[model samples]
Target: MATWHRLGLRDELLARVPFSVTLERHQIAVFLHERRFTAISNICNHKGGPLCEGRVRGEFVMCPWHGWEYSVVTGKGPAGYDEEQVPSFAVEERQDGVYVQTPPVMPRKLVKHKPSHLLETHSKTPGAPPRVLGISTTAMDEANPRFSTSDALLEHAMAMARELQTDTQLIKLRTLKFQHCEGNYSKASHACTWPCAITERDPEDQLSAVYEGLVHWADVVIISTPIRWGNASSLYYKLAERLNCVQNQITIHNNMLIKRKVAGFIITGGQDNIQAVAGGMLTFWSELGFVFPPFPFIAHSRGWDAEDMQNNVRQVKASAALREASRELVERAVDFWKMLDQNRAMMDRPMERAGRKANPLVNPEDAIV
Candidate 1:
């Protein structure tokens, strides 16, 4: 038995070619192209983006969320991705009005994808020592390297972690080839995804190492960045932007990926504003659910006019106090993590946030507008 539901007048549908109609709990997208009417499932195959809100490019509609494209008429993906498709329906212009057939002419087809390794939320290995991860965000040429004060301190921190008998991993952002954040969140709050939209498309993106270290491997994280023009290093900001996906998980799913973890920072530069730089780092990591220990950061900076770069480098290189402070920062972070781990049950952190709330537009069904 074939069932057809009248959507609206043909002229009204033509005026609103790309629109959604929910018929008996079935949401469908209707389109007008080249004097023809076509209907397809309103939900995108990828991340359930609202297809009706997306823009039609020729015969295909590009998803507003992550730019996934599907044919408006056939609901098939472009070229090589044709096998992946959304459900398509038959639309007819009857004497009374425009009607869309129920149950779709073509069913939705999705490729069976191997889930991202970052999505695996494995419990901490029992009896295993907690891990410490150091991220050096001072960008430089790895092959023809220049000494970075921040990187040096990060090395000191890592050395301290090893001496303290904790597992340690150091990530130098300069050495890794990764893409900058492409601003998927600007498209929509739901557009930014876990594992990141860019990471899913490009396998060679090395930021996955950072994600693995922060989310799954590390109980404590130490971020080191040089002050660049009164701010954290450019590489640090780049990494921070990409990390929006991590923070967005809380806003989208109320899921905290970084619980029971601690974070500290090391900021060093000849230019001033160490406090501002450290403040930025502290605020960002806190939103990611990381707790801070006492004196959570260690920093070194000469006043703004101390632009004698060589002398500044020599000063940091010879500063035993800076090295000791770096070690102490990591120690504090590690101790905090252990303390949190020991009283994990007593702490009883809840996922339901008080001040923060999840995006109401995350669901396509509720985002009909």
Candidate 2:
């Protein structure tokens, strides 16, 4: 049996902007949805997005980082992911305050698997090289006015990588300068050329090189950014656009270089509204042959203070969650690599024999003869 904790008065909760409570040690988010109160782990099962800070629409809580929706009542996320049902507690209203009972123990076989074509699409081979990459584009320099949470996330991720003995690289966007040449090739003849050759040095050109390197060398990537105005910083977006150029190249080559890789995101914002940015970034990464992980790390703070970096409520929570999520990412990366290895190992086996199947390529009578 679990123990119950009395949070506060029901009237006090109703007075708050969003009626919610944070489970101090558990890091869970509890909310009042209509007549019943629902409890969900604050960390998004998909990417570590803070569910408590998210908006509740009906029975679902949409992740503020990437718009990943989860059922508040059941804690079940979208299809195709292994997400355990979030534990819900019994709530009773009293004259003095609201009381919530402890959640029940999770079932051993709670997660259900879904049929997927991902394995079929990947041709099994033997001894395929294992490659995993962690790329951080957050700028930590003093030139930017606002404090960046991306830096902290990167630091935490790097620390976890070291603990797991994972090889990762940190790429700072601010240090690289590049020129962004807008308009078609007709208007801007230097579209295909580097900015350095065109006279002045453009920061965009330098940044493009870094983007190209990341896309080319990474088999699995983790991207982190600071949210600005409900979106990733201009620096990260610009880099995203440049990376699209790699996809363009693949298209030109008839998708020969289409390498499906695993990807994850980490985002931090001032006001905590990160869904828009995370959604856009995830969509962008998906278009480039990347498989998005279920969990995303989204962190926020009310205001920026020199000392706040050390003591900010949101940042501390985010940092701890990100560390755990990064560890999971490392394990998943290893699993992905092992899957590839298994696929390679199976390639040498003889193809399975089956009854003659109809071929759309030839007429039925002609094919048999």
Candidate 3:
């Protein structure tokens, strides 16, 4: 036999719900839906997240940790999926107030296991033949692809990397739809989580590909971006902004994610300011624990007055010298990686994270900025 416990006044219960209450050592989530009160276990079936902490959506409350939804009425999952559910309890209305019964411990339900194909890089190192990743950040319609000079150069660079028998893959940012960073770091450094809070909550985020390649797979990364208005492409910065989650791990937790990886850049534009773009990228990547090769980047700019887009396209297409230089950039990237591989023991030795010295996490609030 179970006992009923008064939670609050009936009018007040409707006003404060969906809220959480404790009864006989069991946590319960109470909600008023469709003019009736229902009680369920507050723990989410997926990760033990507090169901009352979640936002109510229609007849369901969505888990903030992974966006898994559970019905507020029956505590069941999506319709027709009776496999997962929370323990629901009996609630009654009395003249004095509303009462809820402590939910009984039900048999444990088995959660369906989901497998992932994404590879992990731990317990692996650069071998005789290196793997390279090339990222093209010039945005264009994927359905009707346009002729992009920067993308063309990036393709040439990756091909040349493969000629050296390196395993290479190209990622076109224009083909993927991923959200921009929402500046969670300003609120708190730990708020910028590793693997990102957005990616953890939203499974469809496409930036995971970039994160996996940069963190786990690649020995060398060749990024190609078309200069826009005296800076890197907007897509490049967009990707960079999302990557702040990567860097924030160092500031808050002092855990380094990127090491033993070499990065090179290829900048192309109709107008000038190539150096400024390269400089900005170098500054950011270096802070992320990446090493640069000699002449770490190469650029193709026709000065400030060369606004003839047609001529710019023709020149890059017809220039054998540019093609050869692209191949040379690949060789240099590999060579630098080989050097680092030889001295990986030294490179892997823990050093004080440079970001922490300035933005220390020891006492984040009171520390001098």
Candidate 4:
């Protein structure tokens, strides 16, 4: 049995909907709805956000940290996710004051998470070759499949990688269903956790495959994206934002999750702006600790006046030189990977950018966001 701790006068709490206070050294949030008072833990179950500081919406409270929801009355999540519940306490009001029963902290359920590829021990065989992965960010709806010139070039690049006897895998972004970045990085730099805070909260997100490939499986990564409005595909940017979680680990934890990884790009668009798109890609990947080869990217663009989309696709499909260039791009990327692999022990750790050492300041999610 637990003892009762007097909170405050009943009238004092009735004025505020969710009156928060410390009782018996435990943070509790008292809520009054339908003329009944209820108490629950003030800490969010997801990331330990201050639940008392969150706003109420109907019967549920939305967490300010990562937007997790829990009912104030039952301490349960929405339908289909009843298992995601918070701790609730028993409360009562006497003639003099309101009080809450402070019980010994109950055992929290341990979440069993799948093993992260970043922590896996890599086992190399006798003279094993480097594995290469090509990711294509060209949007083509499954219902209405269109001939993607960018995807075409990516296929050619990976095909050449296979011919060179390197183990190759191809991933098409259009084929996977993944969520967009929910602006967790804007909350705080440390809030953007590795493996993604979102991915940890919501399982079944397809971005896990990409993470595994980039972190554990591949030595060389070739990314291909089609330009949209003088930029890379929207899917590419969505994946980029999720990948910030990977780099955030480097920024705050100094783990170097992407060590000795080589990256190259293939950009194809009907309109001209390859340099702008490629520049953005290079800067973004470099910040995440990915090294590039000499002439790391290959691009194809007709011109600013190429209004006919059909002719652009037709021309790209028939160009033998473009196909040959894709092969050369893979060969050059592999050459860089081989050179770095020989002296990787000395080259890997030093490649980490200066000032990226482990940060001591703990930046919380609720720090002014």
TM values, all candidates: 0.92, 0.47, 0.69, 0.76
Tens-digit lDDT string for candidate 1 (287-315) = 88888999999999888999899999999
The segments of candidate 4 whose C-alpha lies over 4 angstroms from its true place after superposition are: 1-41, 55-126, 141-144, 187-191, 197-204, 350-369
Rank order by TM-score, top first?
Answer: 1, 4, 3, 2
The top-ranked prediction according to TM-score is 1
Best by lDDT: 1
Point out the worst 10-residue segment of candidate 4 by lDDT: 104-113
Per residue, candidate 3 scores C-alpha lDDT tens digits across 1-369 of: 688999878989878888988787677889878888988777777545567768887888875544567777777878765678877788889999999886443422546645343424356643557989999999888889878888888888888888889988899987777998877666546556677766766788899889988988889999999989999999999999999977877776666788989999999999999889999999898877788999988889898999898999999999998888888888999989988989989998977645443255652222111
Extract clashing residue pairs from model 4: none
How much lDDT does each candidate structure score? 0.87, 0.54, 0.80, 0.80
lDDT of 2 by residue, 335-354 (tens): 66455445645633433324
- Tell me the number of clashing residue pairs for each predicted model: 0, 22, 0, 0
Candidate 3 error regions (>4 Å): 1-7, 20-28, 41-43, 46-50, 53-58, 64-66, 87-110, 119-128, 140-147, 175-212, 234-258, 272-276, 279-291, 303-305, 314-325, 349-369
Deviation (Å) of 282 in candidate 1 = 1.0
Residue pairs clashing in model 3 are: none
